[model samples]
Target: MDVAEAMTLLLSPQGRLDPYPAYERLRAHGPVVEAWPGLHVATGYAVIDEVLRDPRYVVSYEPLPQTTVAGWAESPAVASIARSMLRANPPDHGRMRQIVAGAFTPRRVAALREVVTAQAAALVAAMAERGRDGTTVDVLDAFAYPLPIGVICALLGVPEADRSAFRTWTADLTVVLEPEISEAELAVADRGAVALRDYFRDLVEARRRTPADDLTTALVQAHDAEVGRLDAEELLANLVVLLVAGFETTTNLLGNGLVVLLGHPAHAAALRDNPDLAGAYVEELLRIDSPVQVTSRISSVPVAPGGVPVPAGGEVLLLLGAGNRDPERFADPTRFDPTRPQNQPLSFGGGPHYCLGAALARLEARIAFPLLLRALPDLALAGEPRHRARLTLRGYATLPVTTVTRPHQATGVEPRRTVATTSAERRRIARVSAGERGTPTGAGPGTP
Candidate 1:
């Protein structure tokens, strides 16, 4: 396919379901191909990596008045996402990142290992209980969705009862992150943004009155500190950014990881046999099937990536999903190998834009996956998995899985096993197990 056809396919629901072939076609055309005037697509591993790290490349841009809607431009969702560090550049981005980082310290994230393990185990046990009823459990809801959301809510000092509401708000608000979305969707996102902002405003005030040992309280204190701190808008925007970024990608990672493991029994067995390999397995999963598929950067000045000149203000779409699977960067790029050596997938954008929550995401996946496997050894697919029709942030909409409970041996303990059996059983299982179904299942080097 030509660049135009390829770009069209890449954005379609079917394309989002399996964009690897299109990526390969694009990579064959060149590392950097112009998709349209002033818009270039980067598919090569080295090129995407370089573009992300290049100082001249930026995330912020000034929208032309002709292209923007007057009132829509000022919408809460648009304003918050646009002003947040995720979309900012230079001094502003650095300042916002620094202040947020002060509270999101490594020590603080590292301290959540026990919490992640317990939460993962509890969720998996709950799934196991559902399996006992002979009912298929939606893994996305029962396990993948709750784990990261729970952890992030706990970190932010959000009450458990309020988390479900946040989940709905985040789901609606996340559509704003996509480059292509409907006006109707934008309206929903705007409402979610306003609700989130108002909710956090009250939360921040409460924290200020009574500081607590949580990131939200710490951020509130930083905002109210003597000097060089966040303004009210910046504080609220970053908190929203943190809440969404913290869980959305990690949720995808958990869902995609399970799909991959269940599809490859050998790999699943390996992980079950050596739970310590969870770290390596998580890395490979990230490399093979990244949660965030694409990120863009704008050229601040004339610059060349892959020896092709991009003029000042040109936009380059970094096809991170393609970069992770670039043949030159990975051996047998299409294959999922948990034990692959020296894996360095750019699932997380490189340099200053590298995901701030990388460590926490890794911690969640590492602790959760092993606990999940150990808890539900007989896990198998129950129905066809559904993919969310999102090209930028790829993940399952629903993953129906069942845990086959085997008869206990004389020791009153059931041995670990997989559940693929007869033609009917296999058919039912095959309907949802990654490769067996039409769903795209994989991720890149880190939990995005």
Candidate 2:
């Protein structure tokens, strides 16, 4: 396939199934290829890295809504997402990031290894129980969806009751993140945005009344302690962004990693035997099949990624999935080998706007996968797994599998094994609305 045909498939619903072939074809056209006038698609590892790291290339999602309709800023979702670190550039992004990052340090994230382990253990045990009767279980609906939401809610101090609402909120926000969406989709996203923003606002007020040692309390303190640390909008917006991003990226990682690991039983056994391999395993998994597939940036001035010139204000679609699989970056790019030393995936992105909950996401996968393997040693794919029909965020909508419950044979993965995964799993209504977007970076990274 030529670059045009490749780009076409890469953006289509069919391409979402597996864009690797098209990525290869795109890379064949050199690192940066102009797909249209004033638009480019970047496919090289080094070049995309350079663009991500360069401050000259800004996220620039502020003016995107103006193209859709008048007073687009009136929409809470647009304002909340656009205002957060997800889209902010230099000074604003830096300031907002410092506050959130400080609260979400590596030490803090590492502390959640226990939370991840405990929750994952329970989820896996439940999955085994559900499939014990020879019933095929949807891993995405059963195990993948709940683990990340539980951890994020624990960290954010959101009550257990309110956690269920996040599924709908996250789904709506994700649709909004797409480059091309319908007016109806936009309206759904707008309503979700408003709901999420209001929820956080109420949450902040509650924290003020009864502060707890959680992320929300920390943010509330930051806002109340300083004159201009975090205003109402920025605070609420960041809170909403963090929760959605935290859940979205990690959920995809768990689902995607499960399918990848189970496909290669040897690697899954390796992880079951030695959990330390999880970091490398998850890294390789992310490199081969990234959750956040594409991120874009606009040139602040005349810039060239791979000697291909991009005029000021031009947008470049950074095919992050392509970069991760670049032949120059990794030997035998298509293969999934965890042994590769010094592995770094473009999945979490880089530079100033890197994912704030990246450590949290990694920690969740690093802990969850081992427990899953140990708990479900006989787990095998029970049916044809379905991938979520979306371009930017790649993951499973339903990953079916079956296994016998080894209650007496295997020890409980967690100390307290009472939490049951019996909650109603909501089936996501898959929608595909692809059209020409006026600005390439529609909503900031679903992960960013």
Candidate 3:
């Protein structure tokens, strides 16, 4: 299918279940395929990597025209968020990232592992308590989606009572890939933005009155020390982004990783048997079904992504999802094999614009995955899994699962199932690193 036709499938409800074939068609066409008149898409591994690493490929350019989303036009909250590091380039992006980076530092992320483990265990126990024996549970609602969201809410000091309402706002804002979002959707997005802002305004006020040992309080202190570093609006925007990004992405990662595992029992059994393989298994899962599928960029100057020249101001969609499944780069690319030794994937983007929350996201997944598997060895899909409708972030809307009862113990252990890592795994990692994409060791327990 052509890029336009593929986009139609992509936007349609059914396409979410299987976007790979369409992506493969786009990749087969060339490195660069124009999805829309002003938009160019890079699908292959090399092309996506090149554009991501290219300094000219602007990170924060406005992805769509003004008329695309009415909420973006009407809401200053939306604009403030769009003005964040994700949409800004160079000095601004670097400055914004640095301010927040201290909190998400490697050490801080490592420290968060204990928090993640405790949270995951508590959540699983809660799920068990609320759900009866063999009762159906929506993984997305109960486990997958809630894990990271809960952690972030506590970290950001968002009150427990407001999270459900705030989640609605985040969901409405996430459907930005639409060509023309309706006035209703725009209103939803607008209201969500307002509610979040109001909530944060109150939060900022509380922090100022009585400082706490939390990220928001620290940021408020920084703002006071250095004027223009952050304002009420920017602070709220970053907070909202942190919540949305943390909640949605890691939820999908856990959900999708579980899906991949259940499909491959041997790997699941191996993980159940040998806990040491937890980190490697997570990396392979990330490679197979990346949570953040595509990241958009804009060309500032004349540039060619994989020899396809993109004019200035043109849009480029780096299909990291597709790049991860390229046959040229990975052997049996479509297979869900945990033992893939050369497991380098662009689930996290490349270069200066690489995901800062990557560390936290990985930590959440690593801790969450093992805990779930250990809690319910017989856990499997209870019903059909429905994926969320969006080409941008690939994940499930509802993942129904049933957990089998297992007696609680001090330390859980199971049979070991070992499979050698494929040669393709090492090569893929080397290739991705040679291009300066992602952190070393592919993915570890603490972070990316």
Candidate 4:
């Protein structure tokens, strides 16, 4: 199938698990192609980077029917949540991004280094224990999904006790990030919205009463006389955005990173030997696998960049993962080499609205992955790992795996039982290695 057709098929439930080959085809067809009416797809590296840096291109949904009509009409609750920099265009985007940036300064993220590392260690320990019974574990549910939620909760001053329920709220609000949806999905979206608003309202009230040092309180208090203070609606919206963006995107990164590591044992061994390499490998993983697979933008005026005209009000979908792997930009685009120096991957995006949480996401991955591989060097997918149902937000629903060493052994204590495997199991692993695979299952990473 052609790139457009393959993209359509990949968006279907059947192809979500693996859409990489489709992305390759799209990249080959041209740097830019039309996915559908009012929607153009850009797969080339320079084009994708340009789209992000271009001041004319807007991120606001106000111009698109997706946000103005279907998005808000179906779920009225999104009005407040979607007003932040994430969904805003230029001046509005600039203003909101500035305020949010103050709260998420690189200095602040740097302070989180030790805390993130500790969290990684603890979660890896828990995962190792959970697999003690010789039962397989889904990395998504067990570790990758929870790490960022917990970290963000800690940063936002949301009590650790509420992490689980708060995670559900994050999940519900991000459903729109999926490829396509039906009217019934809107109802579900409503429940998610209501739950999210209520949770944030209560949390906001608590923060207001006792002005703590969390991001929410910081935003509420920063500037003269709360100049940038968000009302209850705006507060909830921004919180939902932070939670959803920080939570899912990092999870996809960790998940996709693990898939890459497991698929390439040499890299895995290298990581096992030099945990410090994780600092650089995380970017390459994100570059090669590109956790955030696709980015959608709208053209404001008639502009031609790649022999393709994007008229006013037209939509463009930048296949960032494809761009990162474009052979025109990177030699050996298919290989997952962590040592590449020119790793200028657009995984965290480019330009003004680039991911505010990029630093935090990288910190989480760098701390989490090496710790995980060290604890369970023998970790491999247990069942036929499957991707989630959604398309817009790429990631796996399940990644069942059996750790090599027992919990005790993994923790550097004495082994309670020998890590066992048979010749047949080795052959099965080899078969999996040799099989012809398409794209990865799940949203193609970088989903939030």
- Model 1 lDDT per residue over 79-197, tens place: 76776778877787776676545333455455556556655655666567557757898988887888787766665667666777887898888877765666787888889999899
Q: What is the per-residue lDDT of model 3 for residues 1-448, given as tens digits with 9 covering 90 to 100?
A: 6778877776566656677877887877876787878788888888888888889878645532356544465564455467565666777666556665655556556766655665567567655544447788887777776677766665565555667776577777766544335677667667767777777778888988986545566567766768877665557777667677767778889989998888888878888777778888888888899988888778889887777778998888878889999888889999887778778789988887777778788778878777777777777888789887766778888888887554244223211211111233223322222222221222222111
List the candidates ranked by TM-score, beginning with the highest: 2, 1, 3, 4
- Specify the poorest-scoring 10-residue window by lDDT in model 1: 439-448
Q: Kindly report the root-mean-square deviation of model 4 from the true structure over all alpha carbons.
A: 10.5
* Regions more than 4 Å wrong, model 3: 61-65, 68-71, 177-180, 407-448
TM-scores vs. true structure, each candidate: 0.88, 0.89, 0.87, 0.85
**What would the per-residue lDDT of candidate 2 be over residues 1-448, giving only the tens digit for each residue?**
7877888888787887888888888888998999887789998999999999998999993634344644456766777788777888778877677665644456545544544565677777767777777898888777778887766665567776787788887777767676556677678888888889889989999989987656677677877889776777788888898888878888898888888888888888898999888889999989989999988899989998799999998889998999999889899988889998878999999987778778778878888888788877888888888887787888888888887776435446542464432221110000000111110111122236
Any runs in candidate 4 off by more than 4 Å, and if so which? 1-7, 61-74, 222-224, 227-229, 404-409, 412-448
lDDT of 4 by residue, 318-430 (tens): 87777888898888998888988778888888887678888778878888788788888878888776776655566777788887466556665333322221233222322
lDDT comparing candidate 3 with the true structure: 0.69
User: What lDDT does the true structure give each of the candidates?
Assistant: 0.75, 0.76, 0.69, 0.68
Candidate closer to the true structure by lDDT (higher is better), 3 or 4: 3
On a 0 to 100 scale, what is the lDDT of residue 196 in model 4?
74
Query: Which regions of candidate 1 fall more than 4 Å away from where they truly are?
Result: 63-72, 103-105, 405-448
